[model samples]
Target: MISSDFDSDGFVDIAGLDSTGRYLLVYFGKGANQFHGLTRYWLITKSDKIYSADLFKKFIPNLISLNKLSGKIEIYSFVNRKLNRNLDISVGYYPENLMFDDFTNSRTKEIICYGKNFGGISLITFQNEDYKIQKIDSENTYANVTPIFLNSDEYLDLAGISLKDQELHIFTNRNLRFSKSTIKKFTDRIAHLASSDFNDDNFKDICLISNSTNELIILYGNGLGGFPTAASFDLQYNADEIIIQDFTKDNLTDILFLDNASKNIFIKILKENHEWNSSIPLTKFNNLISFCLYRTRSQIGILCSEAFERNIFSIVNSSLALEKNIFTLSSNPTSIEVLKNTDEVINEICWIDKLDNNFCILKRNEFNTPERIYRFKLLRQFDSYVINKTLENQLDIVFFSLGKNYFDFVNFNLSDQSISRKTLTIYGAIDKILFFPTDHDTPNVAALNQRGNSNYITVTNPFKINPIIIDEPLVSSSVSNYFFDSVERILFYMQPHQVDTIIEFKSKKFNPTYSQGETKNHFRAEIKKGSQVITHAMDLGDTKKFDILNFFSSKGDGYLLTSFYQTDGYLPDSKEDEIILHDKSKIKAVKNDFSKTNEFYIYNENSQSVESLLSLKKGKRILTKKIKEDKEIREFTINLLPRERRELIYLRNNSPFIYLENF
Candidate 1:
């Protein structure tokens, strides 16, 4: 039996095999104990083994059956209340068991079959319409094989038991190929094998049940494709099946085994000291055929299946003695989705037997309370939706994309229990909707638009009635994108495929630390259309690009700002301001204060002429600032220190420049 959310509605559904009748029975789960839609489909007969997998990654797990008579794998998908065979591949021979795992990490599972008559394992993988089959370990016979990660490398390896050789086979996967590494001298017959990282280490550890001695063996992996250490625990009953998982939610792996004699499930919890606790009975039913881990988003339970019904039990006081509920079935199940509810606080659960069909909703957790069960025909699911508290009154506004060119805006009022929806048609296909917070009561929205083969930008306040859309197309157009700074009422835009050219604008922010009660912060963006473009070039001699950091302008004249670097040399006390350095020595930095603007240069090449030269004085740093708006003579802030470098700053004119007061 296999369990999956066949309708993609989060609740678990069951797909069971009726091999005797050659039919696949499906029961879509409505809730914990509620089910409906007992539908059946003709597939394979009693000799076929059924397994459920999402081979297409399409959210719905399809039923796969390996037919021994036909020697073919058939996949049946549940669609529109009918099970349809989607894929059929011939394997030439039937194997005893099939394992589904993504050995190639390709998101789709590959079929690994073992216990064949030819004494080997075969791999079947599907890519598009083509399928590839490979045979591995054709020499040895494996009773059963499981996927494992034996080494530190993150690849799936094969772990199997060979009853004839009385040995455990570990096939390490290297570059997608498996090579057998044997572990011999297993005195007892190994019945079941499972692997997990029991000690919280990244290495995979193995635990097997020996039916002959009725002992459980533990093999600790050293993470180098070896299980050198072994431990054994005496079991009360013979277990034929083993499951290794973290059932206790403690991050450490635990072992659960089903006793073959009494048909009872038991779990051995792992402790912090890398030891196993005594086996605790986990089943409340008798004559159970099989069991599995039943999990949902909110709870984990153990599901035990019998001939007529399935019982789900949860851990209450660390035991499954208190059975939750038993769900009866008309026929035995082959596969069932236990539960896949994802909501944290589940008020109601909904499910459908077929995709896009009528579904049933059931209220949960109130067993004695009479609740209404509703059956509704499925409506169209929205393409995309986003909710935000964007209004001043703090109500949630949900934006749902109905289609490419239409959007439905929903405003929900919890106090009044009312909802208002309005549809808006956009100029082009809406790629994305971005909401920018504004100081006003209504939030501003920007929608990225794509019409035909070209992209554009549409800016508007979507909350306003008869909202104006400022659509700027970028196709041989000057504007590629635009952003509206609502506070300044300035629209900044960029040209098509332009990245290098930029515009820097500063806004005055209130700050008591400055001379005035405010300071100006420099904000930059790509230059918009109809903006002035400035071009200038300079060569600072022997100065690295990182030495010069920021550039700011005040009233059209640009000032290149930087911090001075210290040289690596010895200094004399008599001439402390000067240092002698080696010619090939590296310049040592004093302190990297990225905001320490200690040096500045008057390098406004656009305002003045180009290709003019200036020299840097040794052991001195300069800072230039305009003292008054009308004054042309720049004020200088100078500090003398030992720094080894002379730079040639480019001036606009070809004339000799000299320092008046400081030199």
Candidate 2:
């Protein structure tokens, strides 16, 4: 329901649209505090407006109506005894609300229409006395918008709240331009906003009703048009709508809220100092929307529309609580969706009155009961769905063979909590099923339908009713194809193969440079593959990376050769010319002295393949390696983690270490 002086009279008039009937009714106010009605059999606009107060700069009083036929807004101005054509407002599909306010705080009101589905605000402010429609930067989806004075100035800013992300967006005013807004995220969804002077500060404070938490958050406004951080208070009751009124007449504002607890109207009385008190009276009604009315000079009553009917609750004496049993609903209501398209515009609450059988629009008849106008059905089930999937993500698409090979894909709608089914054609008891995604704009699933008795991979989908079959090695992990090629079930299907593992031995606490025992047989494990014990090989080493080598021979002579990768570190620095092994007698002495000490041995883990170790003793350190000095011999040893091979040499008297270059 909405109110404006429809006949341009001094008294305020009421207008309501019966959701079931789709007719617009204008309650033209008669002078003596009364109204005579005029009805038009038409679809009520999604957002309604009546400029009873000169809203537009044109000073033209207009009545806004959404043409249900064209989905266009038709504004009518009161000329004679009735309303005539004045103007029409347009936005994309479903303009949520229309309001006339000084959005720029420029002392002039402009016609503003907010777009809900198309996602922007139609700010119809004036430029040089001509209507200029400008839009603010907005998201593709938003909840509601309001012009608020938030800063310490007279400029009007915007606050657009979105339930999608639970954020309150603040759009600062920038004179002739629209400034981008900032968002403050909240934990709870803000359902509605009502302004009142809750504290004694005398500034209009903002109260937002939480849809989920059932709490009313009050943001106290400073006198300089700014508000501090908000504070929350539990309402002790879940409310979908709240209206401020001075029911106690104590100058403290009291709230009349629609409590979902008992589907009722509950009055919360305020103290003399504007504080909410607990304990409110409960009255039940399936009210879609309600407006408070003064019954007599002293008695306050409430007018409520409960989908199919209306109710009037007279305020009890002294208590200010509304009494039940003035009226009731004629049918059961499903749910209500609130669309705010106005600045302080209390408009109609579109209702779904009938649930069963033929649906119709309705309003009050002669006996104040809902009268049906026409009948039609509104859709209940969600028609289309999207099966969006990324190949990396795992979503279950199990096909249960319903006793008789009647297959169905699980079709569940989480929004309405309903279960439905889509047919899948698969026969002859499938043993394995795998779902894989194909490259497509929409999600496409490729299923591997393997039969219990066959050796083929069958893929099924909506378009391809007959399964696509591929014949490949059934014992393989996956079918070898241009697409997906691997599965544990196929790779391990009753077949076993021997794996040759080269187990390089590593010391536990023993040092790699000075270990006593050989590691070739120290650590060993046997692998049994289908009754065959697979023999493994182990390499023993005393160092991670081998470099320099020097040995004193048995003849008191020196023999030396070093790896090419790095410089020889153990040798003394500076003297390039020394009494070294190059001399024939010293080379023979060193080769003879260290011949026995320069040799090491190794036994394999299997007690087989006896590999030798390289003996290169520098000072007291001796590194064990499997390298042999013979040209035809294998490497003495290898290192683990990063494996490196090394070889050793023994010098005889004929071809001795007289001059060794690279080893």
TM per model?
0.47, 0.42
Candidate 1: C-alpha lDDT:
0.51
What TM value does model 2 have?
Answer: 0.42
| Model 1 C-alpha lDDT per residue in residues 402-466, reported as the tens digit of each score | 22776655554433535565566678877556555667765656566677756554556666787
Off by over 4 Å in 2: 20-22, 31-33, 37-53, 57-61, 67-71, 104-108, 115-118, 126-130, 180-183, 223-226, 245-249, 269-274, 279-283, 286-302, 310-663
TM-score of candidate 1 against the unseen true structure = 0.47
What C-alpha lDDT do the candidate models reach, one value each? 0.51, 0.42
Expressed as tens digits, the lDDT of each residue in 1-663 for candidate 2 is: 555555655655556665543456665655333456555535434434223436554444556665323436665666655546555555556665665667665645775565446466667765453566677755535556666666666666776666467667666776746665554677877877656678866676777778587777778877554577577777777776665666544467666787765686665655555566653543456655544443323323454545555532332221111222221121223221111222212211122333242222222222222222233333332111123222222122333321233243433332342434445545434333455354642222333334453333334453444543322324223221111222111111111222433221122221221112222123222222222111111111232222222221222333222111111324322111221222211111011111222222332222222233333334433333322233321212211110122212122211101111012
Name the best candidate (by TM-score).
1
Give, for candidate 1, the lowest lDDT window spanning 10 residues: 649-658
lDDT of the structure predicted as candidate 2: 0.42
